[model samples]
Target: MGPWQLSVSALAQPDKISHLPLRWIRGSRAVMAFTVSVFLSSILSVITAANPPYPPSTVIRKIVWAPVDTITRKAAGSDNLPVTWADDEAIYTTWGDGWGFEPRVPNKLSMGFARIVGAPGNFTGTNIRSPAEQLGGGRSGRKGWGIISVDGVLYLLMGHADRQGGQAQLAWSHDHARTWTFANWKFLQFGLMGFVNYGKDYKGARDNYIYSYSHDGPLADTPADRFILMRVPKNRITERGSWEFFERIDETGHAVWTSDSKRRGAVFYHTDGCLRSAMTYNAPLHRYLWWQQIPVPKGSADRGDTRFEGGFAVYDAPEPWGPWSTAFYTERWDVGPGEHGDFPAKWMSEDGREIYLVFSGNDSFSVRKATLVLAQKY
Candidate 1:
């Protein structure tokens, strides 16, 4: 009887309130006041189910206007070009052949080459490519390409022809923009290889991965180079599936994967006699690769100019591999003085909020979407 006086004699029991009678002690004081009001409503529902309400924003609802046709002007007339966002919303551009095959298509058979499918919202300048029998034709051309949509399906990462004949080819797309199903014509044996880019992480329930690279050797006549990390399984986009290579570092002809608000992971490339331009992050100690000597300011890789110039510069990463930090510079509104240029940019929607900048301008090659808003703390 000393444990705090036996809890004050168990609340001063009068035979523990006797077998309560007297209208059962007024219905036991209304059943002990409804069990202390359901124990304070379950402690306020476990403190509002452990907090999370909303405070971090970037909104630009819709501005999709893609239609610069003539088979995207013979696939942007070839040279490190890229445009991706295909699930049926359409927009998948690619270009190469700066050297390999010489007939860069585009002589109007509806435009020698093709791969266009507009009609998502506002690309109504009209050119809508999509016809050459759903765009097919393979030689040892078509460089650095990577397009992903996984669950809704649409996967293409090219560099085809090899089977003792040469290397590169891993394509997939299931009847939406028409047809394409080549599971492997030579899925990465590295040779003049150039899928030079691709990155996706999705977060949370986890299951979204596609990191493709290679643009400087194995087939510019075998120099033996390396860079691979492909694990795209958000539901399946086949290549016999199952991949994991990670870490080979720069052969750089092109590679962009951004995100850096401290979630970590950054990579920007082009260092193989493209002269130079680099950035890397995935650090705890190592993985910090660097070589950005800065010197892209002469007509900013010109092509005509309608505003927004050149390309390469992406930032936003929590983990695709990084220790990055550079908020915005994907051609930062084509940077100062007379502004009207912005080139080959990508990172078109990933919580960092849409940024699909492309520019060769007026003569045609304009694809823009820069909607990123993040500034709030109170």
Candidate 2:
């Protein structure tokens, strides 16, 4: 946090400045060294990475690890799912294809479903028997969704992209993950701009509605879009009329909510994109934890390390419509670019000290899961 070294050997000397060490003069009398402090500060920022503590151990699970050169076998796989549900019985994940983009046909693809029984360490991994089954109409964009449970009901905030572009819709499941019944309704209209990629969905005991979010802009793993927010009343899942758009918070510190769906705005903006996002309420910290898998590209604008720009980052905020701040971040992850990283609610602790990170990528078989020790809250 102090006393960083700056090398000026490679820097060109300024013309007008007089001081030997460097020009400390004001106005246009500045030299090229004017930017030296700015460069060094950027270095210090990476040195002082605001990363949460790493987990004690990282556990890997394969929902369907099919070798690239398989004979008569098709590895069961579906790794990307913003909708992750967990319980004492089992941990359930849905959406995305574990098979990747193979077969190239896209004709027989189904929304992959999987289950990990027991708990994190003692989990049974995947049963691996007939790992995937068709969900919905199997339309290409029908699988993008954000799911949350209010009381005993589970709500799925599904998004789609057709020839006409993007849109968002809703559905509910009463029998856990065994079956899903889609609401004959539209949450966000066809031309509603963002909220097309609802990464994480949340419900608060102190609040009356369920909150949802999205990160859609430019491309995946780069600076593009911010975290967009939306919500619907708990009592009105069936009533599309109950959905409300989050405008912004007022000066007095109260959240401003309105029924006009077109009022949607990005509560938190980031360049990270192109995948599912995970969110949950951390009771001990009194904040929301947003876990997103952002692939730091080769020429990505570096916030810290140029070689490694984005990976899985933990962003914390006091409100759902976040005045959010970074709690922890990393430039390294096991999955490749455009991959997704997520934290299942059950694997996270109430104090925000420990977490299990899940990673899934393009056309791979296994889903990489790591149990990371979160940085102790300072």
Candidate 3:
């Protein structure tokens, strides 16, 4: 809770260690002194292998900043606009730094790529590549973003992050992650709105198409849970008017789909909305893994003035949009006294069992390694 008060060493739960062999336990404690992140990750790796009665959980390890953060020295300038997606050889992400959602900031948002120096499959050694630079896609602003790679092509699903009154744009990159085609005439529509704010949750090449989701609300509003689902044919996303919206089955037990975007209802609904979320297709568990920030309630309505505050929660579903169940949650863990905690699905293990939960707020990029266990059926 409260800025940086969360100690990494304390993240280990003794109960979870009870089943470990004594020698292994002793070795893990030895790692407590310095390599907290590594030790926690190793332990959880074993825990997941054990098939614990819960979705894997987390062991927060450390706090870090994108090397670029050292230069900007300001939260609003760099690494703040977060949307992550990945390819097999590398984990890729694009962010909005010094871009604006307000009139003064410009309608088109500038974007930058998050750089990681290491080679493929070695995710542990990653740190933000210093000195952020603009990418081809960053030339304009977007909201509800998601990215996927197919046959060496990176496709970014971008929508309006502001009230610009635009639809989702598809950006493409060939020649190995160099640059991209920012926007096309085609866009996604749901309930009379085109900029559904997607990139927060997406699954590429599933069910013969690229499945994605969007939420209806402003950025600052958390617990804002109405989500609409959409899909586009693989490799055909650039074609205007080719996208399809999710239509729930009617009470009469018949599947229905209407060309009218206004008639589309939210595929998944929640009482309160989660501000930011990440969606991943976990190969190990064969399920859709989603992580989101549950905002802290405001004022006496909650317990005093607790504003801009939130924590993390992970959910699992049979598909990208439906029948979701909680896999992990830290209701009391505060990534934000004034900020939010999030998951970059691309940074997760292939099995979908573990990931690094990144926290942003008060000018810091803190991270904790987390995972899912099968705990209690949810």
Q: Which candidate has the highest TM-score of all?
A: 2
Candidate 3 per-residue lDDT, tens place, 187-263, comes to 43421121121122334335456666666543323234466666667667676566666675444323345545676
Q: Report residue 55 deviation for candidate 1 (angstroms).
A: 13
Worst 10 residues of 2 by lDDT: 53-62
TM-score of each: 0.24, 0.61, 0.58
Q: Which has the better TM-score: candidate 2, or candidate 3?
A: 2
Cand. 2 Cα-lDDT: 0.44
Candidate 1 is scored at a TM of: 0.24
lDDT of 1 by residue, 279-342 (tens): 2221211122221112244444322121223333233333333222223333323331111112
- Worst 10 contiguous positions by lDDT, candidate 3: 191-200
Error of 3 at 165 (Å): 8.3
